[model samples]
Target: METTDLSTLPVPLHPGLPMLGNTLAFLRNPLGTLHTLQRQHERLVHLRIGGRHQYLVLRPEDVKHVIQENHRNYGRSPAFEILKIFLGNGLLTSDGDFWRRQRRLAQPAFHRQRLAALTTTMIAETANWIVELKQQRSKQPVNMSQAFMDVTMRIVCKTLFGSDTTGKLDGLSAALDDLNYLANKKMLSPLRFPYSWPTPDNVRSKRARTQVDTFIYGVIEQRRQRDEDKDDLLGMLLSAEDEDTGEKMSDQQLRDECVTIFSAGHETTAVSMAWTIYLLSQHPDVLMRLQAESRTVLGDAVTPSPDLFRSLTYTLQVVQESLRLYPPAWIMSRRAHNPDSIGPYTIPAGDTALISPYLLHRDPTNWPNPDRFDPDRFVPGGPKDQLHSYAYLPFGGGPRLCIGNQFALMEMQILLAMLVRSFELKATPNQRIIPKPLITLRPNQSIWIGLS
Candidate 1:
């Protein structure tokens, strides 16, 4: 790919307008655009968008090269600048040695032991939410999507932050929405305006950032002044010292990580559960089987042990399948620091690679009848065992893979199991459901449903 043949051969470009490239289509319906490209091009499709060299990597091995094999040579894309407004330089946006040190310091918080404790919190909080869900029952339609978002936020705040956002939910939700809009616009728009330009969008984004900063910084200050054993994520993050320097995270770093974790932890799991619920409602056979598994394995249980949670194979399969179809964090981008060979194409220095889980997961080559909702593919020794390592990446791959993978999965399993077991939720008739691709993929507007 990168040998002398590279100079003679050129990367194929996805067609676009003069100077604008695929910005319009990519921004209009990024998932749809990429999915269409996945069908037309081979693995790596090149595009020049507003003077930016963008490569849409479609195959697993090529994605592996960017995010794993030669990962050190690739850093997070500059498009993350928008997220930096609200997320700061947290794990999701940061790169290089700084990211490595931060990763090392934060790794312990998600260890198996810590995750087990978090599981208890997840189970308890989910149980409480289930009771509340039941209590709120009425003839009025319930938007389970928002309900999932609210419940997961509470669980994440309580389990990770050692506090909850009971009254702050509405404020936080609005702030998150505004920030999401700003981030989305920043990523897709042709003009790259400085966030400090004081335009309407900039002003709104700044206000949103201020609200988020105030909330997370307040949480960090509260934890710092506390004397209790701070093993909870927020506590551990506060007390964590770099093994190399014996220095703890700065207030900014802590706030960034807190916001990153909270934004990711609650939102990803909530959307995954929402999609899972929507899928289950559409597939009665899968729903019946999932409910049966829940009743058989977790009958009236407040908290199942890790081993017990793992025993629900079908339930776990359902969650995995749902994630495959509707990954929370749908797209990841990396910029090459040097010339690199990925399959047949050479990634030029400074070229940005877009790896989409949404695209890869739906490839018929990897998944037969890809769009069909089938959980059996994920059975322990089933079809999933044979897929390429990078083919099914709901939580992504490589060292920078999501640190909260286990926390997110466990929360999704527990909540989905409990929600489906003693309850019946049906998607409202004649409703349009589309995956709204923002910071994470979620249902457009509210997913109207009847919960009984």
Candidate 2:
């Protein structure tokens, strides 16, 4: 691997007000500003976010170097601190020894073998939703985004915590929505308009966090009081012991892990399903292919198991392409733990490092016709692995990559195959596909789709 001098880095500062470091400007037009910067400077550019300079890594090689090779030099940024209120020290936010231990314990839960049992659950959830939607087709254009979110939420909740509690989930969903919106505002707002200063959003966020905490704590207590082996991740976590130290996770620790899994597992997969249907609605030929694959791979069966789901290569490829174009975790950041040179710039300790898969996936130099929804780009002999390591970071990379990647993929594949085979998705005329930047990138409005 080659390293470049820090002096040679293209550190172009976008114009901004005196005290704020282009926070408002970036918020207003993040993708546009990044695109403009890419046009004038090298792929790697400097962004003065807040008062500190953060490297906006756009080049594929630079992304790989930071996220994969030198991952230890970086950990998640303080911006993620907002998530701590509910997520606790789960795999998504934990660092150092805590992260390592939790990762080790939780890794098996997402294993191909362990996840195999959950395939029936995933397929059944999808089938139930699809059938319900098919019956209601004449009512009005269905919001596929919300519908999928509901389905994924049910699946994850049932699989993680057993039977569903609609009231608890309703409260949790509302609280999460409030927390995510306010957290984003806090990240982008200047001190003059500090988010903590009695703003409506801040107040709502506090309340929401409380709701989430209450629901999670309730679940934790129920599991502990029962004290019986349930054969779920929570049970395994409770049963797991360290070889050196005989220990189990504290109640708080259990609560955190459960909330983290609930939040992380549901939103991302739901967004992916929504976008896949949106894209499929646009490309009839590809939809036809997906439908054919679904029928061949899984006949009229509603609950095709996870093993059968993973074997559907074409269906998986379509989902992969949708992820490439509209990755739910659109922007990821890391704070430098050690001073390191990335590409032509030296990042000092405590500095933020950014990676936008949205930009990387659309870089024309690496992906030809990058903006086009071409599922064939992911087909066999399409240079999937041959590309730069970081060029395709839909689920992130390196050791800290998403623990549930395999689980999520299996669920999505099964759900998608079941969907396309049963009915065709027709996009509502004049419906807009606005990108709503939540804790994830979601379709802003109801994604209206007619199922036949």
Candidate 3:
């Protein structure tokens, strides 16, 4: 690939309707639009969104350049600015030194060993869900989407706040749903009005944000009153000190981190697990193999420990493949702070760069039969092993990679193992499964599965 002087040559542009640019097309079908661009432009594609210049980077090397190798030249995109209203400059939305500091402080909470110890909590919560699911098996079709959200939310609450406050947090799933809907709406709108306006969507978003803030703040107050440190994430955050300044996080900072973790931790895992189950339900052979692996490794054990869960290799592969097809964080955007050179194109400063795992994972050149659901691609020495490191980034890459990647993986493994062994999941007939690319890739319609 020959390098191109962007100053002299014009980059390939994806033409769109006047004024609206690609905004309407993008809103109508985000994943499809990106896929089309990737196929047409091959490497770098420029898009004009409401007069704003956006670059869609499709190649792995380009993705690596922006996210890892040359990450310093890039920062979180303005697209994520809308999320600051809810995330409040937390790890997800914060950039520069503050992000680094927060990442370091919160890293200990999600360490592998700490996550290993949380296996029991995962099993216990999953067991409770199994019981509830069993009771409702004979009722109307199960909304596995909402059900997984409930399970993952409970697990996150327990793991983050400890078991004492787990059940105390209700309406979290609904509140988060509202937030996701509002955030995505604002992100895709060509003419986004200030959030301060009294629009109906803004009103709903504020109410939803207030509900979440009220609950999290209440938790912080209760923990503060205790005057004792516990072993949970909240406890760690309360006692965590900045390595440089030796200062602790304030109430608002703590609240922000908690809310960020609360939203990111649960929403992604739930969607991933829900989509994984849905995929398994569609592929009976894969489901059979997964069940066999579960039974063989678990051997009638009611609950799975970390070691036993690790032995379910095929189950983990299914999770990986599901994420490839339906990555929770489907699209990521970054802003170039300085002029940067990718393989053959120069990205000018101030240009927005968009990277989508949804498109990258499905690229025909990197993945053969990309749309097929095949867990074997993730096995040792499998096809995915041959691909570039950045080519398979469901959790993203570089310095800002998802902090809870390990935690999310372990939680999904435990839930899938327990649920698959305990019940038979079948998708409701006549329901079309559409991946809605919002903050996370979710089912556009309700995913109804009959649990037998």
Candidate 4:
């Protein structure tokens, strides 16, 4: 469908070497370089990442048109082919009817009722994290990134799979690390390093995938072998039948969905929590306000029970603001399935489109004092719905919007409330907080924070 026609859509060939189109330039400082391109070329800029034509979408209307109005024509980008190695045909990587069916099967598993039952699981996991911090109170400062990773890993495994799989937490963590490394490296690599090669990195990734698959399949097999009923997501999935076909997900289908959920479910939330803690450390007043809000809301109560944090407006606002600043899924991509006109440019069927939350979050036009840390931007008096639908996208928009949004939000809110209520975040005097862009935008180094 034609939206807007621009006979002269400026496609500047930014100074680059033969065969490579703005690859090195874009890689150096992704955000800065994209901003420069946006300024020069306006909302629709055609870039070549290693000779690959990539359209950088900046305007809110363009984003809405692509992601909301005509979403089906776009699927995950070819750049994410590396992710397919690990995730298989999971929700994040899959497209068309496969994505639709998987989403349908998995949606009910994370329904409010099911997630509400897992609130106790979140509390216990966060408490475990606090205990670890309390033990190291004087010994050494805690690494908030690693700590959050561990907490979310446990919570996701326990709540989604079952409590018994908690023993496999270390293996899952290692697998996730390996997957992240391979996926990010492949993004910038020209040769598109083959995972089948006998290289150490390839071998490690393959081995990590095997371990993760083993764990996932083990859970699937055990569920099948068991005659009795269990109530976790896995159990629910096995029981859930398609309304149209009245069919259950095959073993492989179930495993793919599990891996997708396990990967997207935990890692993104972990990154969000890590950034929230790190940012809070940088802004102590925000931290103090959060602590006061949490304590006042939960008075004398220590743990993060559902009743204690369900309506904690301030705490939720802080989490929302954190997501706005450092959205975990930094860049989302989609390739047109058909020739589509977006604003001034005509995108052919094979061309890929990208919506960068990184740029959207820091857009000067949308956010006032865009670089500052102000949770109040989301407070009551703040500009409500002023930002366009796709302007402030952290969880994304449209039919493919993260199905786990509520579950992730609930997990973050509960964990943030529980941790802030118990400890004051103290950042290291000269610690570095570099954003490592991978499957998610996470801290490159450990975020050192001391407890009160």
Q: List candidate 4 stretches off by more than 4 Å.
A: 1-15
Query: How many Å off is the CA of 293 in candidate 1?
Result: 0.6
lDDT of 2: 0.77
Q: Which stretches of candidate 1 lie over 4 Å from their true place?
A: 1-8, 302-307
lDDT of each: 0.84, 0.77, 0.85, 0.80
Lowest summed lDDT over 10 consecutive residues: which window, candidate 1? 1-10
Model 3: per-residue lDDT, tens digit, 428-450? Answer: 78888989877889888768888
TM-score of 2: 0.92
**TM-scores for the candidates:** 0.95, 0.92, 0.95, 0.94
Off by over 4 Å in 3: 1-8
Compose the digit string of candidate 1's lDDT tens values, residues 1-452: 55466543567888899777887887778788877898899878887765788888888988888898889999988778667876789999998999999999999998888888778778888888888888988987788878988888888788877666678877877787677777877876667778668888889988998988888888777766765666578888877889878999999999889888878887778778888888888898899899899888887776555567767889889999999999988988889999888755788999898889998899999899999999999998899999899999999899988998988888888888888887887768877788988778888867767888
Q: Poorest 10 consecutive residues of model 2 by lDDT?
A: 187-196
Lowest lDDT sum, 10 consecutive residues, model 4, at 4-13
Model 4 residue 432 lDDT score = 75
How do the candidates rank by lDDT, highest first? 3, 1, 4, 2
RMSD after CA superposition, every candidate = 2.2, 3.0, 2.2, 2.6
Clashes in model 4: which pairs?
none
